[model samples]
Target: MKAARFHAARDIRVEDVPAPGAPGPTQVLVKNQFCGICGTDLHEYLGGPIFIPTAPHSYTGGQVPQILGHEYSGVVEAVGSQVTSVKPGDRVSIQPMVSPRDDYYGRRGQYQLSEQLAIIGLSHPWGGMAEYSLVEDYNAIPMPDDLSTEHAALIEPTAVTVYATHRGGVKPGDSVLVAGAGPIGQLQVMAARAAGATRIFLVDLNDNRLEMAHRLVEGLITLNPGSTDVLREVRARTAGGVGVDVAFECVGAEAPLGLCLEAVRRQGVVVQVGMQGKPPALDGFTLTYKDVDLRGSWCYSTLMWPQVAALIASGQLPAEKVVTRHIALDDVVEQGFEALLDKAGTQLKILIEL
Candidate 1:
């Protein structure tokens, strides 16, 4: 099978590799259909061995040279005897988390936070970029026939946005301020709208991204923070000298993180949805005096996958329109990597169709 394997920074190459070994008792073999390139993948490819705790020899799954995709959908080609949730020929979206189902976290329904967690494609034997991927039955969520593989591939990332929005507790009448308009940020806006945010303010330096955000959602007021003072504008627009009810920080950079803290109302919720390369300074004085609630969110749970899938299928959430471009597996370099890196905020989601 031909898989795009990451060797070093700016050094991903497609290589012919052996197919996945036979499924384990709880495993299922899925024929790859669609995979989404993620920001973490970009970070790893640009400058990383990334995070492989056990190494020396590495892997596409459960190891390094990691096939490196967590967002994807595939068809079940076969399954081991113990796989009862999905049978041969079933269409499923991969959840990608490896956790003991009977463990304390699993029993308490927070398996995403379990100590034994290992993500597929990141730490497994095979990933969706290859012809087939090996995943445990528990990681396979059956996507409905109404959902396309393109949309099914979205469940993973959309799940992240959904979880973050839910964590922020955006209510129907609340106002939201989103710090970035990247793919995740756009999804975060959509999730905020669904959760009942009446007004949304998106701040990004790029006009292209702000325009995309304006066209994507109705009644979203955007700001080019490069030209205007976003904090000043937000304060002027909202009642009192303070800002929005909820502020979602979607860019990991220092400026955006700082602005998120400055833009929210006193005692408002601020969820840090982005991963920063370096730690940004916190406003200890503001937190001490103003009582701002700062929270960090990670990836979503299995329970949220079904809801994300339903949102996409129902078209209440415009995940499909967010796809800026689609490329074949062979052209991932030109269409996926360089274009994304070079253009940055200009493009939204880029898809790899199998």
Candidate 2:
């Protein structure tokens, strides 16, 4: 099988590797159809060891030369003896997360928060950027025939945004602001609107992404904080100079994350959706005076995948709109990863079609 493996920073290779062996009693073998290159993958390719283990990971026990994809979809090629939920020929999306069953967080039903957490692609032997993958049965979520494999590849990231919106408590008629117009930020806009937020603002320094966000999301207002005063603009558009009801920081930077503190109305909520490279400073005065509720959202609950998949199936999520480019497995390093680093900021989601 041909797979893209990460050996070190700036070194991803497409090489012929051993295919994942037959499934274990509670496992399934998935033949890759479509795999999306995510921001986390970029981090690993650019400067990492962030999630890719330097030493062996405790949970998955996977080490370096790790496979490098997680947001993906495939067909069930085979199932293990104990697998009953899905069978051969079933199309599915992967949840990707893995953790030890006996871990404290796992026992509490918060497996994503487990200290020994290891994602399938980043820590396990098989990932979607390959010809085949071996995953636990619980990680495979069946997809309806009506759903395209392209859309199925987006379920993982979409689930993240759905969880973020839920965490922020977006309600009907609320005004929302997303402080980043990257792929996740765009999805945050849609998720907030789906949660019944009436007015949505997408803030970014890149004009290309802002334009794409405006086009992809209905009734979205774009702001370039680089040129415009984002805080003033948001307050002017919202009620009582109070600003948006909920603000999502999706850039994972100090500037954008800081904007969330100033952009939300008094008593409003701010959800941190993006993973920051370093700890961002918080404004104590703004947090104290406005009584703003700040919340951190990690990955989604195991139960959130079904809801996200249903949203994609229902045509409400418009996940396909976020796809800016598609490349073959062989071109993943150049066309897929490098293109996203283009200064134009034109690319959003880049999918590798296997």
Candidate 3:
């Protein structure tokens, strides 16, 4: 089997590797079809070993020189003896979060909040970038026959956006302000719309990404902080100049977080969706004065697979609209990663077609 393994920063190699032959008692062997290169993968490529462990991880025990990919879809080549959820020849979307042991959070049905959470591609031995990979039978959620494999691969990231909406408590006729136009930000817009948000506002420095978001999502208002006063504009356009009902900081930066805090109405909710590189400086005054609720949204719930898959399959959330390009596994580094990192910000989601 050919796999792309991360050796170090700027060093991802595509070489032949030993195949994951068979499944364990509760495992499933999947023939990977499509995989999406995530922002986490790019962070690892640039300056990492962040999530990719240098030493043995506390949970999965995976280390550096790891296979990189989590957003992917495939067909089940084989299933283990105890696996009854899926069988051979079933098309599935891989829910990569692995909580090998029961914990307080897991006991509460919040597996993603478990302290020893391990992701499939980042910390687990097998990943979807390869032709074949082994996963727990529970990780493989069977897909609907009408869903395309490309769309199936998107279920993972869509889960993130959907969970963010849930975390923000976005309701029908609510107004939403998303402070980023990246891939996740674009998906945030779609998720907000599907959650029945009547008005959606997006802010980003990159005009290209803002244009892409406007084109992909209907009735989206885009704002570039570089040219316009985002806070004033957002407040003016919102109901009674109070501000949006909910605001999401998707850029993971100090400025965007500040924007979200100030743009949201008093007593409104603000969900932090992006992974911040460092602890951002907080405006305690605004938080205290407005009585705003600031919350952090991590990964999706372990049980969100079925609901997310249904949303994408039904076209309520057009996950495919964010896909800018698709390349083969061999071209992942140059065409996929490099293309995404381009300063022009033209690309969004780049899928690796196996």
Candidate 4:
């Protein structure tokens, strides 16, 4: 088996490793076919050692000497006796959250927020950036035969967007604004539109990204915040300062997040879908004055994976359009992660084909 391991920040290598055996009673063994490097993976590569929950990792519970990839898809090589959801040769994508059975949060449908949660890429012995992965049966969702591995590899991130947009209560006929044009931001655009948001605005400083956003979204408008005030432009297009009815903050930067805070109309919802490096500052008075709902979204509910998969299978969301590049497992270091650092013009999801 060959695995891409994260030894520390700025370090990832594909090395020959042990092949996992057949499943345990509650587990399944998957031979991976495709994996995607995500923004979180970039954070772990650059600024982290952050959230693995073991003390032996005084620096990182296991970021170093860790198998690092979560967004992926594969075929089940074997399944344990207790695994009723899937079987041998079944193509599947994993939902990477772990939870304690006794936890009240897990029982409440908020497993994404469970205190005992451990992400597969960060805490497990093997994750998707490998030739094989061992995951619990509950984590594996069988993929429709028509779904390509690249699109299947995207189900995880697409699940995140689906979860967040639903949490924001986005509806048809609502004018929506996505305050960023990164991969997640662009997905936010697609997700918002799919969820019935009629008029959508994608705001960003990068004209290249905005252009890409425009290309991915058929009728959605792209707004250049650098050239003109974004709020003004969206409103001018929308007819008044009542502004967009809903906003999604997808860059994780205060500039875009703050713009989301100010741009949604009174009573509109603002969903925070990106990971912020720092706490964003907000005027508490605005919440009281505007009577708006500004909430943060973490990952998705396990229940959401089926719909996400269906969206991909149906081509309604066109998940493949987001895949800007494909690389072999060996080239993730430069082409997937590092390229994201310097890329513009034409890049979105970068998938590693195993």
Candidate 5:
């Protein structure tokens, strides 16, 4: 089998490797089809051992050179004796999160918050970038018959946006603002709209991304802070100059957080979806004076995957609309990762076809 393994920062190699063994009693072996490169993978490649363990991971007990991909979909090639939920030839999406069953958080149905949480590609021996990978049967979510394998690969990331929008308490007729127009930012708009938000506002410095957001999502008002007063523009566009009911910060930068605070109405909620490299100082006075509900959102719960898949099946979330490029596994490094890193701002959701 061919797999791309991460040896060190800036050192990912695609080489021939032994295929994974058959599934354990509770695991399933899947043949990879479509895998999406994630921002976390970029962070690992650029300057990590961040999540890719230098020593054995507490959960998966695996370390670098690790296979680097999490967002992916595949077809089940084989199933363990105990796996009855899905059979061979079933199309499924992989949920990479892993944790000990005995962990306090896992026991309480909050496994995503478990202390020993480790991801498949970053910590386990198998990952979707390879020709075949193995995962616990519990993580193999069946895709609806209506969805193509390419679209199923989007469920993981789509779950993230769905959970974030839910965290913001997006209700019908609510007005919302999403900061940044990256892939996650673009999905944030759709998620917010699906949650029944009538008016959506998006902010980004890049006109191309803002334009892309407008094109992909109907009724989205886009503004580039570099050229206009984003806060003032949002206020004028929204009713009564009171600002949006909810604000989302999808760009993990200092400025976007402040803009989220400025764009949200009094007593409204602000959800932080993007992971910042460094902590940004908060304006204590502003938060206190407005009585705003500022919150942090992390990874989605395991239950969110099915809901997101159903949303995609129902056409509420057209995940493929954001896909700008697709490349073979052999060209993942140059055509997928490097292209995303380029400042030309021409790509989104680059899928690696195995």
Candidate 6:
């Protein structure tokens, strides 16, 4: 089997590796069809060992030189004796999260918040970038026959945005302000719309991404801090000069976080959907005076795979709209990862077709 393994920063190699032969009981062996390179993968390529463990991970025991590709779709090549959710020849999207131990959070059905969380591809031995990978039966959620493999690969990332909306408590007729127009941000707009947000505003420094967001969602208001005063523009559009009902900070930066805090209406919610590199300073005054609710949205719930898959399959989410390019596994580093690394780049979700 050929796999792309992360050796170190800027060192991802495509080479032949020993194949994961068979599935263990309660596991599934999948022949990967399509995989999407995620922002986490890019961070590892640039300067990491962040999530990719340098030592043995506490849960999965996976170390560096890890295979990378969590957002993927594949067909079941084989299933273990105990597997019942899926069988051979069934197409499915990989859920990626693996909860090895029954922690307090896992016991409560909040597996994503488990203290010893180990994600497939990042901390687990097998990953979607390869031709074949192994996953627990629970991680392989079968897709509808009408769904394309490319769309199925998008389910994982879509889960992130959907979970963010859930955390923000987005409801019908509410307004939303999303800061950052990257792939996740674009999906946030769609998810917010699906949640019945009537008016949506998107802010990004990159005009290209803003334009992409506009095309993805009809009637989206895009603001570029470069030209437009985003805070002023957003407030002006809202009723009574009050800000949006819910604001999401998808850029994972101080400025964007600040923008989200300032752009949300009084007593509104601000969900931090992006992974911040460092602890960002919060405006205590705004938080205290405005009675704003600041919340952090990590990965999606372990049980959300089915719901997200259905949304994509039904065309309510349109996860496929974010896929900007497709490349082979051999071209993942140059064409897939590097293309997305370009700040002025037009690429969004670049899928590696195996």
In the range 1-354, model 1's lDDT, one tens digit per residue, is: 888777677877878888888898988989989998887778877778675434732322255576767789999988998888999888899998777767789888898887777777666666777778888888888989899877899888888888998889888789899998888888888888878888789988888888888766788989988899898889888877678999999988888877888888999888999998888888778765768899898888777778999998997787876788988878888788777787556667888887
Per-residue lDDT for 1-354 in model 2, tens only? 999999999999999999988899999999999999989999998998788888888768787899889999999999999999999999999989987777788788888888888898898877899999999998999987778888999999999999999999999999999988888999888888888998899999999888888766678899998899988889898989889999999988988878998999899999999999998888899899999999999979876777898898897888888999989999998898899988899899999999
Candidate 4 C-alpha lDDT tens digits along 1-354: 889888777878889988888789999999898998888888888976665433443321443577889899898899898889998999898888766656788778777787667778887677899989998888888878788766888988888888888989988878898887887888778888788888899888888787777666678888887688887877777746688888998888888877887888889898989888989888678767989898888878887887888887887787777788989888888888888877564567888888
Residue pairs clashing, model 5: none
Which window of 10 residues has the lowest lDDT sum in candidate 1?
A: 52-61
Which of the two candidates, 3 or 4, achieves a greater lDDT against the reference?
3
Cα lDDT tens digits for candidate 3, 185-264: 99999999999998999999999998888776678999999999988898888889999999999878888999999999
- What is the Å distance of residue 221 in model 1 from its true position? 1.1
Q: Candidate 3 lDDT (Cα, whole model)?
A: 0.92
Candidate 3 lDDT at 112 equals 86
Q: What is candidate 6's lDDT per residue for 1-354, written digit by digit as tens?
A: 999999899999998999997899999999999999988999899998889989888878888889898999999999999999999999999999988546788778888888788899999998999999999998999998778888999999999999999999999999999998888999999999999998999998888888777777788999989899888888899988999999999888898999898999999999999999999898999988999999999989889988998898898899888889989999998898899999885999999999
**Where in model 1 is the C-alpha error above 4 Å?**
52-61
Query: Could you tell which candidate, 2 or 5, scores higher by lDDT?
Result: 2
- Of 2 and 4, which scores higher on lDDT? 2
Model 3 is weakest, by summed lDDT over 10 consecutive residues, at: 210-219
lDDT of each: 0.82, 0.89, 0.92, 0.82, 0.89, 0.91
RMSD of each: 2.0, 1.0, 0.9, 2.1, 1.0, 1.0
Segments of candidate 2 deviating more than 4 angstroms: none
Better of 1 and 6 by lDDT: 6
TM-score of each: 0.95, 0.98, 0.98, 0.95, 0.98, 0.98
